[model samples]
Target: MELIYMKKFLDACHQAKRITELMPKLPERMTPRHIHVIDALFQLEQKEDSVKVSDVSGFLGVTRPSITKLLNELESLGAVEKIPDEADRRVTLIRLTEKGKKYYNFYVEEYQGWLLKQLGEADTEEFMTTVNTIARVYKIVSDQKTAPVFPGEE
Candidate 1:
């Protein structure tokens, strides 16, 4: 009985591993750092000014120097522009150009669209239930790692 559920869990893990394998490597001259920065800018959308280096650094838990280097690479690609912040001349803000925005959208949305396509045939609630069940079992195993054993279980 437990083996049946174990098989199901292993199957799901294998499928997720395949999904990771399917994701492409970054393009020439670009690293995951650049993508992380782009994603940070998208999320840090401030009305008054463009996103700043500090913002990306904070979001990614990386140092400003490293993020600045990645930003330099992105700037050379003409994907992003560094503008002087309106409120603070000392601070530089990062803003994605149209090309950068398109690139960011492509990277973020393509996988999401592919996933929706894969799940499209399933009924939504049933899909959610199955996903939730997998999540529940993962928690059970995670808890067991820290749980104290009963007297006979050593």
Candidate 2:
């Protein structure tokens, strides 16, 4: 049975994975996970005056302990700091340091430049249509799946 559509989907996935080669590499002492955390903080801070550890954990869909560990590493690198909330002395909030801001700005600029270069006069509306189609297909596929099986459950 030749699933021609599946072949195209798998090929697209391979190409998408390869697209990372065009991305700017992270600066020293920063991993992809760190970038994710910084991005979450960047977006969350836009809506909230102060972002808590739980905010990041919820944004990233990870455990609070895992977020705390990553925050500790980021803090050690001077990328983020934990400060007491002004209204509540016992509550702490997370904020990016100047270094983190630099990282975020640099990466966003670089990534945008790369994406624009790749677009190279492409039609914006058509590009968006294609992106939306892929997202809808993904949602349909995900909705068809049952609960995921864990390793030990099998």
Candidate 3:
């Protein structure tokens, strides 16, 4: 890639990272990682009643310690519960509490989520530029049709 476009790309990447910070957030509190963990639990909730720590870890593809850390927070926040199965004393099952269900609902139910507000923030000219540049870059990388044509290429 050329130096000028590379510089702009880095700037856009930095802006994207701050996109979440720019928006109004949910009440229970969270980081990006926490969001994913909660989402995994919500997806699991849709499919199975026997949700265990192992099940969450499997869904997230993360190590036990990482899921455990998030689970501990979610449990303490009243968003989740960890209970030992009746038939097996050693196995623990995890599930969303009513508060958690509300929290997940808040994320999925609306255009109010920060990401959905991105398009509204950009003006017409800026939005078109971003879209066109992204399309050009995608075609260049995905199809290998040609070298990247930066913003003002002949």
Candidate 4:
């Protein structure tokens, strides 16, 4: 039973990966990873006054090094600006640049449109119910596991 469940989960993850791979071809300047970091920045927009590199790392459940790499990429792309904290010069605060905001909004709209088009052909009620069910199951399983139970595992 566990094996069967694992197989299905793997299949689902493969399908999701395929979709993510296609996102880069959707007339966007940023890669999917860049978009993910931008989305995290958007979520932290309300706390603009206190947004820090560590804060973003914690919020995104990623390591500081990983966030640093993403930040470096974003900085190179002129999508984010890193400023030294006034009180503590060692700490860096990150904020989205105007270009970042523009691209983020564009990607958000494009992604939304793509999702809407994909789901429009399905029965809305059933599709939403399935999505909710899957989300709940995923949350429960993810919270109970120490490691990811899906892809990237051998």
lDDT of 4 by residue, 45-80 (tens): 776776888888888878999999988889888999
Worst 10 residues of 4 by lDDT: 22-31
Instruction: Output the better candidate (1/3) by TM-score.
Output: 3
TM-score of 1: 0.58
Candidate 3 has a TM-score of 0.62
Ranking by lDDT: 2, 4, 1, 3
Q: Please provide, for model 2 over 6-55, each residue's C-alpha lDDT reduced to its tens digit, 9 standing for 90 to 100.
A: 78876886787666544578767777678778888989998998899999
For all predictions, the C-alpha RMSD in Å is 6.5, 4.0, 9.0, 5.0
Off by over 4 Å in 1: 1-22, 46-48, 116-154
Candidate 4: deviation at residue 145, Å?
A: 10
* Model 1: lowest-lDDT 10 consecutive positions: 42-51
Q: Model-by-model lDDT, in order?
A: 0.78, 0.83, 0.77, 0.80
- What range of 10 consecutive residues in model 2 has the weakest lDDT sum? 16-25
For candidate 3, the clash count comes to 0
Best by lDDT: 2
Runs of candidate 3 exceeding 4 Å displacement: 3-9, 111-154
Per-residue CA lDDT of candidate 1, range 1-154, in tens?
7899889878988997676555567667876557667767777774434577887888776789988998999999878899987788999988888978877777767765777787778798887887898778778777777778999988
**Whole-model lDDT, model 1:** 0.78
| Candidate 4: residue 137 lDDT (0-100) | 64
Using TM-score, give the best candidate's number.
Answer: 4
Cα deviation at 154, candidate 3, in Å, is 44
